[model samples]
Target chain A: MSMLLLVRKETVSTRYKVVVCRDLGPDVMPLLRGKPELELVVWPEDRACDRRWLLENIHGAAGVIVMLTDKVSGSSLQVVSTMSVGYEHVDVNAVAKRGLKLGYTPDVLTDAVADLSVMLALMAGRNGGIGISVVQKGQWTEYPWAPFGFCGPQLSTTAASPTRKIGFIGFGRIAQATLARLVPFGITHCLYSSNPSSAPSSERDAQLAQKYNLQSVKRVDIDEVARESDVLFILAPGGSGTYHVVNETLLRKMKPTSILVNASRGTLVDSDALAKALREGWIWGAGIDVVEGEPQVSVDHPLVKEPKCVIVPHIASATLETRRDMATRAAQNLIAAILGGQMPAQVDLRGFA
Target chain B: MSMLLLVRKETVSTRYKVVVCRDLGPDVMPLLRGKPELELVVWPEDRACDRRWLLENIHGAAGVIVMLTDKVSGSSLQVVSTMSVGYEHVDVNAVAKRGLKLGYTPDVLTDAVADLSVMLALMAGRNGGIGISVVQKGQWTEYPWAPFGFCGPQLSTTAASPTRKIGFIGFGRIAQATLARLVPFGITHCLYSSNPSSAPSSERDAQLAQKYNLQSVKRVDIDEVARESDVLFILAPGGSGTYHVVNETLLRKMKPTSILVNASRGTLVDSDALAKALREGWIWGAGIDVVEGEPQVSVDHPLVKEPKCVIVPHIASATLETRRDMATRAAQNLIAAILGGQMPAQVDLRGFA
Candidate 1:
């Protein structure tokens, strides 16, 4: 009877299956493999996992790991883990309703995203794209460096102008991290707008200001953020509520010399309006990582065609180290959930559940 | 007799002829124009003043303000000022022998250059050039986001791996400014190589390390710098001693994951050797602002053709504020020297004089 019980336990443990949407690379694959009891059904491809393949393979899976391209539906899975910070593609409501735990990699990408945001701002402010194009297009020798040649607004402050104000649409982790980076650039003031329901924290603002040696950090209305910012960063969460938040009205209100940087959701910004702003000189320039309808953006995209706009296709967190960490975390979450252990970074779906 | 003395005073004041190589823009033109007594001779065209034109126009000038494109020969001028930090194009020996004051705009551009240095580092580490090229080539939509797609090394550190070593070829004002920017990225250690004749600054290094919350900030040999650095910056002056300082030997010594950035002088790094390093994966990538024989870089240039290299025409100080300040300071130096007053930023040429 005891021997039969051991056999039964082995059968139960070996029956557990987990599905991985795509290859998580060598660095992260070992975690899933280490769990001998949990079988990993990985999509063997260099590209994003096929939707048909994912749906077919994920049928009896106890836990599944996904990327932005993979869609999750209401299933009998115990857990779902995504290898990205943003889970807009994932159906969180479906996962919650089915009593499935959700995991995501967030903090690992904060620094990488923050670094890229500052890079974009500096690139826009210094006209880096246009300057580089001149060299690439073999026009450098012909166009002599004039006093104002390729010159845009400065990112840092000078002794002559000691004050620089920075603004943010959403003062979240990424925004705060970006603010920290800009502090050395001699940014004197900061203005941010959070959800209207959120309470204002003057003490926290004062502490942040003092820590960064800034003049002030205040929470303001969206209009004030648009008007006062020398460099405005759009870092709000993406959804219907934030759609077109920075439309024509807000773009028109911004200082003509101020720079606009959107490292957040694309839907938050009206790309047509921004392109028009660049064309009409309503604003100095813009740097966008994500567009309204991205991955679908073509060469003829209005923002891409704008001479003053610098656009990169949604690569704010495309750093090897961060991606590796995120992949590892996602794998760990899957492995832990299947083994009935606590997941490393499970998203709290308590509200939906 | 009183009227004759008044006419003589007017003639003496108006006799001060100043030659400007190009338009100094509104910010600085007004400064020179404010002194109505100084007669201004500016090159009419927007391009770099022709060699013959500058020579002819500078003949009787009491002072001359030049750009990097303008060559200043020894003349019977009171002062020679360059609107750039580097005055290599100007013949200092000739200026000194003629007992003329030399002035340049330096400190004003420190912040701009430093900001660009960080931007270049991030760009190189993140494969910014290749990523943008992919989008511009209309391959972005076709290529779905993979788990490890377009991923490059991270510039910032994580708690799990908290140490990041930064190396500098020359630890000067700009290097220090760059170091300040990297502190928030959690740089643990720094290595630098300086002139062998200079004394070691252990005390100063200790203070800097402590202030920046670093483990160590020590001067080391070039080989050690290559071996120890995760990100190495070439910030030394460009000349014979530093030419090809980071050549094949040094390139081979660098870690395969390391990144090299040259924002100083192009001559300091060997382009062919760097291209080979990147091609062979000896080093991760390179971000170069200035290239050898710049303003002449073609599409066929080895470094330009390198897939991992990010090259920009030398525009490190090409920000509106910095350029404006530089032009103003250059003008001020010329105006002061011509009027026999103390120039604000005169280069001490007393030794040569």
Candidate 2:
């Protein structure tokens, strides 16, 4: 039943020992089991890989398989294969400085993340949570359906408004993929912002605009992206330079008819500012998949309590197919790194250093 | 602020009386007010049109602007204009037998409904409500993010699985619109059922297949739709012939990974059968906007009680822009039918007879 690549022949006499932060599941674990050229040490629990166990096993290893939760550090570590798109949870500079090859699942999860981004935009535009609550909370019978009672801003273009604009904080693979999905919805214009450290892409922008038959797909300043967009997606990565990019000033510029979706990182957005924006109707609504202090959010959390805020736990990339692909890719990365001196998806670490 | 059509100029000796079920808000009411050619008698209550008030005011009316709930059956009524796409609540046969023109709003709400359909599919596929519960209930803290914590089915395809199949119960305008939206999601195959009363379109199917570069877009039967679709959308009309089309037998034939989304009428699906299927994992999940007896749903409702069921009160067409457009269309229909002798988008009721 394994679709995994067959283990290579002509192995070296000595088997290389590798530590896996957690079990890669039945679908992928068989790739490491009984391999003549590899020794696998996987965490034996159903939860996150314990830090102590990782620390103990990371030494004297040729390679390691990890999730975003597992930190990697060892003098003997040759490779660190993480099954997540973002490496913000891991110290990328340190990994590179230690001369370890880093393999991550990026492109494999892009479709899943982009799907969630579009879904979030639609949900937020409709004030979707309120409609869900009316049925879930047994208020449906208490109150009757009225004309224009639950109406929120429409996401699609109608005859009255034939052109719709969408913006992105980061114009990367996921953002472009999300834009591609919005084309059939009759999106006419696009605005996006890239990190100031990165160069502009007018040529690529022209190509994308022409491809989608959009009015314009321009690289603009963050202020313009915030102000002009009817729906804004924050797909930027997290770090100090981009931290709290969607703060008070940025929130103020967003239209009251617009929707905000954060499918990328938590720290890139300011929670309090967004909460205030929603409270004051600065924006129509927000669909948040990641919170600033996520996995620690409370029922009383400001964003959680906002009726218009449709918050999902950090599950943007959590799909059975995507997770399986990620795990399989991670396993393959580990196998390739240890046995063949190469990784299928080796993350370029030179830039981080 | 008025996009309402201008009143016609004709110096008539007498004005025709028209009764409106609900007050069309500021943007629309001006068109009806101060009209020398018409007298308006509207229900003053903010609730569903009071039946007694409507009946009392319906006598001798030239035309009536009614909501879906306000049924019309008056001897002197010449025209009935309802601001809803579905006229199932109104007796079309009776209206046609009485020789009254029926004007209803359609086409304008197509994009809004299609947008909701896609949203529901994504929500259902991701088990979207559970993720919301995890965050909204503050269980996020207790249950830390796991490798597969909230994993459900992925709506999009990846390299490993390039082709995805989508099914629709009805292949009408909204269904085609919904399919157009799914094109970018990498949906490779489409299966739909037009009413058996309608003719098959092999030519249209070929054209659609060529346009979308799909594997196949075939018109199939209900059994095939149930068995083959990874995500099945119920967008059919409501009537006895199609009632409970997705009953126990149809549900039992569906894939365990499939999602059922009902953005159309609820009666088309059997709630008990669907709940049972979900309970036994015969189908993955369901996203329902309309219930058999909606606006009467409670927490105790079988479908609502299902953990995988993402229910929204019947709001598939609820969008601020769409609602306004419908109201304006309805007003235009009433004005044209009474003053200018032509409704903008009149529904032909001859077929009902």
TM-score of each: 0.95, 0.95
lDDT of 2 by residue, A1-353 (tens): 76977866675688888998877778878888857688888889888878999989878998988886677788888888888888787788888888878889888889999999988998898878988888889998765656687889888898898878899999899999999999999999999999888887899899999999999999999999999999999998886768999999999998999999999888998899999999999999999888887778998888998999999988888998888888888988888877785577888888776
Candidate 2: regions farther than 4 A off: A1-12, B1-12
Which CAPRI quality tier does the interface of model 2 achieve? Answer: medium
Q: For residues A1-353, what per-residue lDDT tens digits would candidate 1 score against the true structure?
A: 35544444344436667888888888888878876787888889788788888888888888889987788663558888998887777777777778888889888889988988998898888787787677666777876667888788888898887889999999989999999988888899999999898888999999998899888999999999999999999988887779899999999999988999998889999889999999998889988888877788888988888878877777888887888888989988877887778888888888774
True contacts kept of 1: 0.64
Q: What docking grade does candidate 1 earn?
A: medium
* Candidate 2: RMSD to truth: 4.0
Looking at model 1, residue A303 earns an lDDT score of 83
Candidate 2 chain B minimal-lDDT segment of 10 residues: B141-150
True-structure lDDT of candidate 2: 0.88
Tens-place lDDT digits, model 2, residues B1-353: 76988877878697889999888887788888857788889888778887888888899999899986677788888889989887887888888888888899989989999999999999999989888877888988765566677898888998887878999999988999999999999999999877988988999999999999899999988899999999999998786767898899999999999999999888898999999999999999999888898777878889988989998888888998888898899988888888886688988776777
B152 in model 2: Cα distance from truth in Å? 1.8
